[model samples]
Target chain A: MSLSLENVSAGYAGRPVLSGLDLAEVPSGSIVALVGANGAGKSTLLRGIAGLGEAKGRIVLDGQDISELPPEMLVGRIGYLPQALPQGSSLIAYEAVMSAVRAARPDSPRAGGAAAIEQVFDTLGLRDLAMRRLRELSGGQRQMVGLAQVLVRKPRLLLLDEPTSALDLRWQLTVLETVRRMADAEGAICVIAIHDINLALRFCDRLVVLGGGGVLSSGPPATALDADVLRRAYGIEARVEACSRGFAIVLADHALSLDHHSP
Target chain B: MTRHLTALQERSASLADLYGGFIRNRLIAIGLLAVGLACSLVLDVATGPSGLPVADILTGLLDRDALPRGQAVILWNIRLPYAVMAVLVGAALGLAGAEMQTVLNNPLASPFTLGVSAAATLGAALAMALEPDVPGLDETWLIPLSAFACAMAATLLIQTLAGRFGAGTDTVVLFGIAMLFAMNALLWLVQYVASTDALQQMVFWTMGSLARATWEKVAVVALVLAACVPLSMRSVWAMTALRGGDDHARSFGIPVERLRLRVLLRVSLLSAAAVAFVGTIGFIGLVGPHIARLTLGEDHRFYLPGSALAGALLLSLASIASKNLVPGLILPVGIVTSLVGIPLFMALILTQGRRP
Candidate 1:
């Protein structure tokens, strides 16, 4: 499936944060990273696409304009994980994921539920926490469970906002790696609003740099990320240099004056 | 690749086993609570002013001919209705409290938080103070009917206000609290200007006794509770998802706004019916859900019924204590409920290794 955005504008309380923005087709089986400085509408863009907040634009999925589709219509087709992880639930991780599955797919037969939930638990390595209460789990652990709740549904489109903000380095790579494998295996389109540029380059097929209330650049990471885009979007003097293994790495030199290039 | 597949299957099976065990434990707790409720019902029926043996109550339940006329009159006419009313009202309040807490996202929220009880009290006070004279309605039915009407009026007011603005949690809770204070002030106003006899009756009504219970009142509350349980069960998964947060539930395509409004409506019906029939039994609605959460976790499949059963059990035991505690004179069941509920609630809180 291909997803595209046309003249998408989104914000809260009648204040437009990202407006008149357009994005090219993001094909199925591709992972695209949304990278920008703070307050650059990375979350607004994702929330707009997810239909969580107020937005005025067309979000087309597979050539069908789904922007006007009610949230119930988008249940099984789209999954969005918010930046804030869930807290204060006494439900265990397994039950929480099961609740997501049951709530999203209310009419589905219950026979396949056990297998689907178990597979997600295995994929996310949350078997040990299946019986542990969410309130007892640490923040990073709860973040993993939150992702598990989303992943268990196997939505055609996955939108993750800051999925790795609470994780350690090991878990950070593990989560990204899992998302990458799932996207390819299931032919799902994954759009992650993330802040870590290098990690985005490492796992994502393309980068969409958002700034100035619109897209600054959009292409393969090797083409879209560079010194100029970084300086313009983030107001940081940075270098996009090739490492010994020929992978792109960003090295920051200094912060430029924010008065000129602030989004 | 085959070995990897086998290992994955094993891991999945083990995880399923663990989940099954957890579910089994919750089911067992539910079963135990049901059994306890049944035992408490029997105990409540037997412990009264005139000592009726448990053996006689059980035998008389199946074979009415077994007991003498006087004993049978006591069992069928007075004790049985009172005990059954206690269970049904407790269950209604318990279920209402569970939904109230879930929708409001507050552990401290109960049916009383919405001002239904206070409204009912005000209605009762007004009835006592004014002594309204209607041709068909009996004096016996006036207080409860008036109380039920006022409680439902309060609910409708909240519903309209929420629909006008938004049924967001903070807004709904704030409105409920505001209604509570307003109703209390109006009730005090009614009580202040009443005669000595009317004032005493108002005080007695607010204390909430099951002494006036009849089989008809018991049946009405039962019907309301029956209708509500299925609706609550239908939203079980969505309610469970909501415990994560509102945004989380909305992510699952569970319309959080509509769900909250619907639950509040159900809570209002249950609370109004309960507090209408049995004065203002406050403790069960608040503590029933807490007991369920502590023992059975937050899976609404178990937790909802668990709350109901817990409420019934707590109220039944309180009924027995009220009858037997001060021999020859039964304290108000509401007074006994607090006396019984607080100690058990504190015990559960202390014994549980963790609090969520």
Candidate 2:
């Protein structure tokens, strides 16, 4: 199975943020990191793919044009986690996840739903927090619950917008590792809009970097990330060095001149 | 590895058991609320000024001929309608408030937040001031009839505006607040030019009373609420998702905008039916959902019914208080609700502030 985007233009309020974007054959069972600076339309692209925002063009998943499908048709098939964590709900985490499962797939039998929710809570290692109200959970814990909400659906295409923005280092790794496992085990296509480039490099199979309202580069992280790409995309002079364990690590030097840059 | 698997299985079993217990507890709470509501209804019907005995109230409810002729007439016509109307109107407002609060993502958003009550008040004021002469229309019935019409009109206007300017919480809430202010200003203007007698009537109507409740009005509110509760329950999971916020709800493939619009429409219907018949009974709409949330949590399965039951209980108790507040003078039910509800609402808010 593969996902492809052709000449996609996504934006808010009829203003194009990402225009004429294309990606060929994003095979299933792969994790792709969507990395870019702020205002780089990383979120717009994700929202566009998730069909939560306006987009014009073709997003084909598994030989079907998913972009044309109704939002309800995307349930349990295209899971999205917004940048903001779930908040202020008096519902317990268990009920929150169970409700998501029931909402997305109302026709599914209740017995199966209970087991599915239990499995997700087990997978997230949040069984202890399951009975706690969302408002009682910390930011990281709530973020985890939000992740559990999407993960319980077990979508074919997971679109996460800054899922780890509020999480600490260990929790961030836990999230990415869970995504990686989903891609490998379930063949889910995971595209994460993330700011932590090093974490992305370490965890993701491929990096789809955006700059200047378009794709800057798309390849395996080791090949796609470099000094030139970093300078152009993020307006920073940085070094792409291999760590002792042969992992790519970015070492930033200084900010490049941004006088003429619109990004 | 064998021990790890066993541990995993055991933990899953425990979690599943915990979830079962949680659901059972919520159901029990709902059952308790229902029982409480039933008791309040009985108490409301029993505690009236005519000095009817509780045994007579019970016997009259079961067998109309058990009471003396005048007592039977009072029980069946006055006490029964009043008590039943309290429960129905309270349930309507409570369920409407619960949906409004969830869809708007605002704890303070009650049925009146959309200006239905305000518009109803304006209609009542106009009816009092103008005293429109319609052929064959009862002079006393004009106020509630006009109020119901104006409330429905405001609902349509709000619905149109929601469709026009995307039904996000902010747009709907801001427009509703704007409508509320506009209606209040119009009501004041109408009251300013009215005769002293009309002014007095307007003031009394704004305070809201169940004194005018008849079997017909009771049926109207009951019919609307009966239609609404099932519809609210149908959207329970979607509303539950909405508590996670719009984006979270949308991600679950729940159309958040459309759901908000539909909920707003339903809430408008329930609130209009309630406030039109009963006048502007405040606090029940705001406090009912909070009480439900405190007792039953935000699972709309429980929350919706819990809110409805809580509202019914609160109003039923308030109805009893309205009758007994003074020795011979029955204070307006709305006055009792406000006087009792304000402290309860404040306490809930303060306790909520201490939570994460």
Candidate 3:
């Protein structure tokens, strides 16, 4: 399976935030990081692909045109986790994930609902919290449950918008590791819109840096995110170094002089 | 290690029990509500002004020729239709209230409480004042017919505006309030222009009563509620999604606007049929859903039906109270419901606060 975006122009309401943007073909068994500044349209790109916002262009997933497909047809094939989670929902974690699964396939019986739900709980290490209501959980737990809702759908194309923004460091790595394993094992295409460039460079198989409204650079992270590209994507003077672990790391020195340069 | 394994087994056993217990509790609560509503209906019919015995009423209903003319009229025409209408209209308001709250994502969003019933009353008042000289329109039917039509018009108007611009829970609430004020002013204008007899009739309509529950009116309201409940049930999953929030619900492919619009139509049908029949009876619609939430939790499948049953029980009980409270002088059922619904509402709040 593969996913690609071509000539994708989209925005909220009528104003175009991203225009004529083209992304490289993202194949299965790979996790892609969409790294961009706050207003660089990373979330918009994902929402556009998910048909959440007004978008004009082609989003081909596994050789099928997603934008042309009806919403019911696209569901269960593509799942999106928005950045914000609803607060004070009294739904238990197990029920919340089950609702998402049923939303994906409304009329089918869950053959083994209890075991399947328990499997998801164990996979996410949420066994203890499974019975806890959403309102009772902490922010990080809520974020994990939000991700679990998306994963339980078993969608082929997963679009996660800052899913770990509220998570702690341990849970953040755990979530990213679980998502990476899901992609590799299921041959699913996963696109994560992340703010941390270092996390992106470390875990992502491929990185697509965004700026203004178009793709700035995209390739293997070590080559894609040089100091100059870092300065362009984010207004920060940074250094990319290969650590002893045989992967690249970004070390930010200071904020770049916006007076002379444009990010 | 042996103890730990037993602990795991116990945990799994409890988890399995959770679902069984949840289902059982909801079913049992609904059953109890049904039984209570039945009792209230029977007691209400038996305790009317003429004091017909329960056995006599049943015998009269079973065989009209077995009883005298006055008893037959009281059982079939007056008390029987009145009690049955209470259940039907109560269920309508209850179901309407539950669906409206879920779709709008606000606990306080009910047609009766939000001035929809008042708007319908204003419509009925207009119908009375104009007494439209159209052929084929009976004098007795004009008020309710106009009330149902105008209630639907107000609902569509509010829903259309909310769909276009002010679609959020808060915005829709404000729109409902604005609508309430406009309808009340229109009603006052009708009163100012009407003669003495018309004004007195309008005042009584505002108070609300089941004295006008004819077989035809009850049938119309019952049919409307029957149709509306199933239609609302068809979208039960989508409504559950909505309780989390519109954007969250939309992420799962639930069309938020379309779902809201559909539920709004069902709400309009149920509430219009109800308030048109018995003037502005607001408390049951508001309190019924709250009772349902307290007893059945928030799953729309159980909550919707539970609310209908609760509403039926509340209104029927209120009917009985309206009869026995003042003895010979039966206060308006609307007044009795408020007098009863408020204390019950406070009790629910106190109990819920103790839970979490």
Candidate 4:
């Protein structure tokens, strides 16, 4: 079960956001990191894959064309954790997760559904606050609740947009680790758009660096974090060094003046 | 480790426990409605221009032949229809109010807030002012038919105007208010042109009375509510998703605009039917749903039916209270509802404000 994007072009209205973007097949059961600057079309690429945007060209899921499928139908096969978590009024934590489970399977038996959703809550360590209302939860706790809904169905393809952007340091590591475990254990293909290079290097198996609405480099962390690629994509001079666990790209200075002098 | 496992078990059970919780809440609400309805029936029979004892009222209801002709006329012709009309109209308003609030995604949204009742009133006024002088035209059917038409028109107009301004709550409320003013002005025009007797009739209509609730009128209102309530319930999942927000609902396969339009139409029909027969009964739509939510929480499946039942009970109780206010001098049913509903709603708002 792999997802392939072939010559995919998409945009809002008539203005192009991602143009002629080509990528090799994304293998299942791997944590693939999509790293790009703001407005580099990282989010748009994810949205296009999730069938939440208009795009030209084929998005084949498990070798099946799914470009024309509506979001609801595609939702059953793909789970998307949107940038903003939904705020339900007066809904307790347990009720909120159960509602999402019901949405995915409205006719499932009560006991079975309860057990399945409970597995997610237990995994996320959200059981302690299950009876509390959403408004009562802290920001990190709320994000966990949001994550529980996405994982409840154990979807094949998971699309997460900046899942750690709103979290504290503790929650950020917790969520990234959870995503990695989910991909490994459930054989789910995970694509996360992340800003923290260190976090991605630690968790992601492969990194696809996007710039100017296209893939600039795609390989292991060491090759993807080369000085030239980092300088070209983010306009930063970076020293790529090896670590015991993985490679790290350390930002030295702005690479803008280097471009001017070289030309 | 054992304590942590136990805690996890408790938390897991909590989410699954809502089904039982929702059922228990609904049962309590239904029980309260039953008690209120019984009290209404007893009060309706006991108090009138001619007062009777509780025993006599029960005897009359159980064995109609035992009652005297005039008492029979009052019981069967006037009181019965009045009580039935109150229940039906209250149920309609309550259901419509709940539906509107869910669809509009605003706690303040109601049929009256959207100027539905005012539009119905304008239609009733037009019917009175333009009474056909033809020999066979009946005045009784004129108000209801015209009111239904006008209400539907108002619903379509509001949708179109709201669409133009973007379908946000603020824009919808503003458009509704503007329509209310425009309709009220039209109503005043009708009053100005009407004869003295006709003008008095119009004023009485505006005050909202169950005095005119005949068997035929009760049947119409009941039929409308019966159709509207079931239809509205079909959107329970969509409405529940809607509570999450528009984007959430859309992601769940609900076509938000189409669902909104369907709910708006049903609410408009319900409101128009209630107002056409009973005049502009206000606070039942506003207060009844709020009471239901206080008891049933915000889940629409429970909230919608709970609101309908509570509305019926509240309206019937109000009608009974108005009848008993002055034994020989009957106040309009609307007065009793407002007198009871306003303070109750204010208290709810105040209490909710104090909470997180």
Candidate 5:
């Protein structure tokens, strides 16, 4: 029910993007926000845990090392959703999600009854669009369908790589709310890479700020997302504030002073 | 509560029917194409050099002893075997083309896109030119064996390229096209250096004739086709996941590269069996999948068999055209396939309302 990454290094083609990154225990029934600048190994870290990248190190889930597990073994417990949605599929949203459900359990009988796919569809407010082909759906709708694919698996450890990048405001809130509800209700450990600081601070139970290919600060959002960490990680001078209702938020007023190096 | 029960029953019934409808529609398409192939088989048998009487052919099929000796030889020896080869070869090419397109995620991908047929042609031409009587490779089977080996070699090269440079779209297709051009150049070089008789044999092999069909050859190809197809059906579900794209397939735990490797090997075997028997018969491997996609969509459960049947129908009909198109002479089935396939392909594109 708890997830811990001691030291993980991963990259593409032997060039390490994330170098010895570490995150302490993330307890069950919590949302951990992962925020970092571009090329700070956000997606790579998520993919590495899913056994998709060239990763080396122990990723202990409830004290069991999953780093060396084969893809088929690791896949049953971990679910990772990438940033870009798959394109040009003629399958309807319902069929697409059903296919994923079947694929996630290749050994079992295709026990994901139509109701399972339909339940996810209805939960995401996609009942009206369930039968629509994936290629025909808009970006936001496709992103929602992608989340349904992962949620259908009901993995113990969930990783979302910028899940809200293409979502509209209402659906974005709905999706994050669903993630939190799944965490609290199902006791799943969820880590989401996000760009929106206010939503992350408000919804997430803990924050892990990534910088220089590793965690720059780690604590509750109020303690970890200070001006120093924001300047170091995002290279922007920012301030953390609380709204009148006491929900935390981040406001960036100017770009921080830094040496710019162009390749 | 009773009202709710009825609604739930109706909803679940409709859900079952949704899947049932998919299988039913695919079966109907297969049935229609199967009937068309049956008709083409009859035409192929009835309209030959020494055309057998249709009444006698039918009666002979029902009772082998009912056929007169001359008519029996023509029906059993020449036309029946040729007709069977046409369908089996067509089906093999069609299935290979369907899998190739699915793996590459390119609608235009064909069995020949990876240079399998071209490599086979080059291998066959080399066998004719050099007459390498490789031991254990039967003299009669040398050309085909050589061709199959060469086609498999091309597949291996593409597999290596795919492994080295990511297995996503365009890597294998680009490498295959490169091999195609290179093989064509090599095939021409072999043709240039050959003597008159060897050159004639090589040229005729590339033109793709059904005149070489025999009962034994038909049975061998049929056996290969039979073994290749059912094995492919097992992978149809994984291939279905692939239609959503490699990343999507992988996320669902489908091994994309491994699936591609296995399917590509199956494709090589199918295409090599086909062209080895009939030379480089064109169009079936290119258009069969398109016909299937347009008919059954991208689901490989139906798409694979649908493609196979459509290819069978096209090639069987083309075999008939090869005989009837010229009153005095039977043109090469390869030439007739292009003559028939181009128009059929154009109609499919026009009716499908999409640019190919």
Candidate 6:
């Protein structure tokens, strides 16, 4: 039982952003990184998987062919943290997390039960600030709260869009580490759309690089993080340094000069 | 060291316990609503043109054979329908207001902002002015039906304008304000065309009165309100998702446009029905939802029902107070609502500040 996309094509308003994309199998209990530049259709792919957008392909989960299911039923098995965390004026931190869990199970006993709620708060490290209003929190704190909300249900399939965009350095590391731990411990399939290439190389088991509305490359970081792939996708001439642990992409001076000269 | 660590853990556990206790204590709010309902019913029956004892009122309601004919007629035919209409109209307005707030994601949004009451008033005035000279026109049913139709038309117009302008809250509210002015002008034109008697009647009706309440009228209004409230409440989960903003709602698998349209239709039905019967009662829709939010927090499940109950109690109490304020004369219910609700809302604003 795993997640797979077969020859998927999707976009908005008849304009195709992702065409003929195929992923045979995404292993359960693994962190898969989706790396792309600004307009590389990474967000669109995640949206299609989450059933937020229309796609002309089959998305099979546990071999049940869930491509045609309504979003409410799909939500039971999948948890999604969108790219933006909306700021609600009146909702407090604890209430926001509770709402997400309630979305999955409107009448679930786990939502307001003392034991379940306490466990969520303790795991998220939100015990001290549980009573604080959402308007009072900083952007990074709000992002963490948003992430914790989707984790409340511990869904089988987790999709995150730019989860660490608003986080500070420490919180970024903490959040990525938590995502890794969640996938490993719970046997859940996790797909994260991340802009930080180094974090992707460090944490993800495999990388899917998208460029210009299609898949540029997909493989282990050691194989996919080559200079030619970076140059084509990011418009940058880069040097790939292979190390004992892994590899890193260092942008050359000419790439930096070209970036500065671009309109 | 172990004792100190245990003490710290105990304090954290106690704080979580307190948070749980506070939310579970929602029963207190339900109790308060029950008490308010009972008090309003007693006062509504007791304080009228003819004063009756509480025992006699209860006996009249229970055992129809036990009361005098005059008291029974006054209690059953007059005050009972009036009280019932007050409860229904108040509940509809409050529910609609809360739904609007949630749908628009703005605390200030209400049915009145969409010109619903204004359009209904204009429609009623037109019926009164234009149908008098025609052969055998019954104003009672014609006026309310016209009001309902016109209010629905106004709602559709506002929705169409919103769609054209990208369906944002600011555009919808702006269109509503424009429609209010347009309806007000039509109402003024109707007044200019009316005969002396017709004009006076229109003016009085516009001011609002529960004295015109009848059992049949209350039944129709009650049926419309009852149908709309549950349909609107069913959208509470969607409304909560929408409160997270449009993109968030979309990501959560909600069709943003469909949800907005559903809420708009429900609120329009509720507002049109209430305004058709009550003649544009103000402030209850605006103030009722605010009070509910302050007392019950912002969960629409609790907030919508709480607002309905609180609005019913507030308006019924206002009607009772209006009757008693002058010994022999009665003020229009709308006047009383404004006079009582404005100062109370002002006080609330001062105390709470502008907190969404």
lDDT of each: 0.88, 0.88, 0.82, 0.77, 0.83, 0.78
**Pairs that collide, model 2:** none
Highest-TM-score candidate: 2
lDDT of 2 at B87: 92
Candidate 5 residue A156 C-alpha distance from true site, Å: 1.3
Question: Tens-digit lDDT track for model 3 on A1-263?
Answer: 89888898978868888889887788887889999888898998888888888888888887778866777878868888888666656566777777666655667767226666777777888877876677778888988888887887777888999988988888889989899899889998889999887788888989999887888899998799888887888888889999899889988899968774564
DockQ (CA atoms), all models: 0.63, 0.69, 0.43, 0.32, 0.43, 0.26
Candidate 2 positional error at B110, Å = 0.8
Model 2 C-alpha lDDT per residue in residues A37-109, reported as the tens digit of each score: 9999999999998888899899998888985666666675889998865667899998889888887766665
The residue-by-residue lDDT of candidate 6 on B101-144, one tens digit each, is: 88788877887888888999988888888774445656578888
Q: Is model 5 an incorrect, acceptable, medium or high docking prediction?
A: acceptable
B168: Cα error in model 5, Å:
4.5
Q: Looking at every candidate separately, what fraction of the true A–B Cα contacts under 8 Å does it contain?
A: 0.74, 0.77, 0.31, 0.19, 0.36, 0.20
Error of 1 at B146 (Å): 1.3
Which stretches in model 5 have alpha-carbon errors above 4 Å? A68-70, A256-263, B1-17, B49-55, B132-139, B160-170, B346-356
The B-chain TM-score of model 2 reads 0.95
lDDT of 4 by residue, B1-356 (tens): 99999777665565557446756766877787778777876777566777677776678888988888788777888878888888889899999898888777677777798788888888887877777664565778787778877977998998887667666656767888898998888888888989887787778888889888999899989888878877877667567656666655544445677777778778888998899888989888888888887777666767888888888888888887897778677899888888888888899999877866
The DockQ ranking, best first, is: 2, 1, 5, 3, 4, 6
**lDDT against true structure, model 4:** 0.77
TM-score-superior candidate, 2 or 6 = 2
Highest DockQ against the true fold, candidate = 2
Alpha carbon deviation, residue A135, candidate 5 (Å): 2.4
Q: Write the per-residue lDDT of candidate 5 for residues A93-147, one digit (tens) a residue.
A: 7666776767667556655677777677667777666656777788888889889
